[model samples]
Target: MSGSGACEGLPGAVRVVAGVSGSPGSLTALRRAAREAARRGGELWPVIAWELPGGEFHAARSSVPPPLRERCEQLAREELLDVLDTMFGAAGPGVPLHALIARGRPGQALVQIADRDTDVLVLGAGHRGRLHRLLSPSVSHYCLTHATCPVLAVPPSPLEAHLATVCRRNSWHLRLDAGQLTEREKPRGRVRDA
Candidate 1:
C-alpha cells in the first residue's frame, strides 16, 4: 500500500524502512533512517509492530469479547502514531514519511516489509544489558539475518557504547585464550559481556 493514499506507488526511487517501538533506540533508528533516506533521495517508511494480547487467541476470543480486542488494537495504533509524531515533529517536512502498523512479531513484520517494500532497512540495538543481549534474539539481529535489502543495525547510544566496547574487547581476548579461533576471525557484531 502507499504511504498516505490508495494503491498508488511510492514517490521515490528508493525506500528506507525503519522499525519503531517508542523506545529511545527506535527513535535513534528512525532518525538515522530518515537521514539516510534524505541523503539517498528516497522516502522513509516507519513500521510499528504489535501483537494481540494473550487472551485474544481464537480459543479464548469468545470469552474476551470483541470490544476489548478492538480497544486493544486501537490503543496500539494510537501509541504507534504518537511515537511517530514525537520523533518526526508536527511539520516533518524534508523527508516524506510513511507510517505503518503491522500485527505480528516486530522482526517478522519488519522483514516482510523489507522483502517487499524497501531498499535499505534500519533498526536500533535496544537495551544494552549484557544478559538481555545474550539471552534474547534482538529484532536487529533477526532483520540482519533475514532482510532481503541492506540492513543497518545502529549501535547503541553513547551511554551504552563503552559497555559494548568492553564486551567486544573481553570476548576477543577470551576467544584467543581458548584457541577456538584465530586473530583473523572477527565477530559479526558487538559481543556482549558474560
Candidate 2:
C-alpha cells in the first residue's frame, strides 16, 4: 500500500518471507525474494528453521549417542547461519533484511510463515539429485502445494537471477539505482526465442 506492487499477484505490497536452509540453492532463493520485496517496497523476512533429521526423533533413547548427536545438531545451526550471512552479504547494504529462527519441520515452518503473512513466499530447490524427481520432493513444491499465497520458484538460471536482482533495485518504494529490467532480462536468447 505504500506504492504500486512491482511483482505480479501480490495483493498490494507484501512482507516477503524466504526460507533459508543453508543449502547452496537456498541463497539463490533468498536473493530472488529480496529483489521482489525491494521492487515492491515490501518487507523481507529471512527465516531459518531448525529441523531435526528424519528418524532422529523416533530412535530409542538408548540408541542415541549424545556427544556425536550434539555436534551434528550444532553443525546444522551453524550452517544455517553461514548461509544467511552469505546471502545477506551478497544482497549488499540498504536492502532491508530481517532474520528469523524457529524450531520445527522446515516445510511446516515455511508453510506457517506463509500462512501468517500475506506476502508472497519464496523457496529454493537444491540439487536433490534423482531422489528429487523420483520423490517429487522440493520445498518450493511443498509450499506451492500448501502455502496460502502465490509462491515464486526461482530457477537456477543466471538470467532469472539477474532479473530478481534488478527487480529489487527497481522496487517501487525504493530508489531505482540498479540496471533496468530490460537491461537484465533474457540475457542468452533473443526476445522471440525465449
Candidate 3:
C-alpha cells in the first residue's frame, strides 16, 4: 500500500511508526511504539517492508512471475497481521494502530511512511555479529541517519539476548551449563575502566 494511503483512515496527526519483522527485537519496538503513541495521543503505524527473494537486481533481469510476486506480498501482509495479533491479541494495543505492508527495502519504507516532521520512527537495534552485519544492511542505522523525524532504536530485551545465546550454543553443539546461565542472569554492577 502507498504510504499516504496507509494513513488515510488512521486517526491522529502524530504517529509512532514502528518497523516490524516478526522478530523478538521488532516486537519489543512495536510495544514501545504503542506506548509512545498512547502517550503522545497519536496512532501506531507498524510497517513491514518486503522484497522479492533474489533482490531487485535479479528481479529486474528475470521479470518475476506474477504468482510468485503476489505470494510474496501476501506473505508480507500475513506477517504484519500475525505480529500485531501475537503482540496485542484481541484486546489490541489500547491505541489506534495502522499496520502497513510495503514492498521495498525495510529502512526506506519505514522512512517514507513516517514522513511527517511530527512522526517518530521506532526500530529494533538487535545484536548482530560481524558476519550478520557484513551480509545485511543495518535498518536501524539507516533510519537513524536518514529519517527526517526523530528515531528511537530500541535495544532487544534481556530475554531476547539470552535466547540468542542459547540458540547460538545449540547451533554450535556447545554444552549448556545451567550454572553459567544463572550467573549470566544475575545483574552486574558498573565497572570503571582500570
On lDDT, the candidate that comes out on top is: 3
Q: TM-score for candidate 1, please give it.
A: 0.69
Q: Of 1 and 2, which scores higher on TM-score?
A: 1
Give the clashing residue pairs of candidate 2, or none. 39-171
Candidate 2 C-alpha lDDT tens digits along 1-194: 11011223345546788887765567788888888888878767777766344443654444656776566556656776677667665545245655566556677777776664567788776544686568655667778888987787766655555655666566756676544545544568556645
lDDT of 3 at 12: 39
Please, what are the lDDT tens digits per residue for candidate 1 over residues 10-36?
744687888988777888888899999
Over the full model, what C-alpha lDDT does candidate 1 score relative to the true structure?
0.74
Q: Of models 2 and 3, which has the larger TM-score?
A: 3
In candidate 3, which residue ranges exceed 4 Å CA deviation? 1-5, 9-12, 178-194
Worst 10 residues of 2 by lDDT: 1-10
Q: lDDT by residue for model 3 over 1-194, one digit each (tens)? A: 33335565354378899999999999999999999999998888899998999887789899899999999989998888889899999999998777888888999888988888899999999999999999999999999999999999998998997888899899999999888777745448876789
Q: Which sections of candidate 1 miss by over 4 Å?
A: 1-12, 55-64, 116-118, 133-136, 160-194
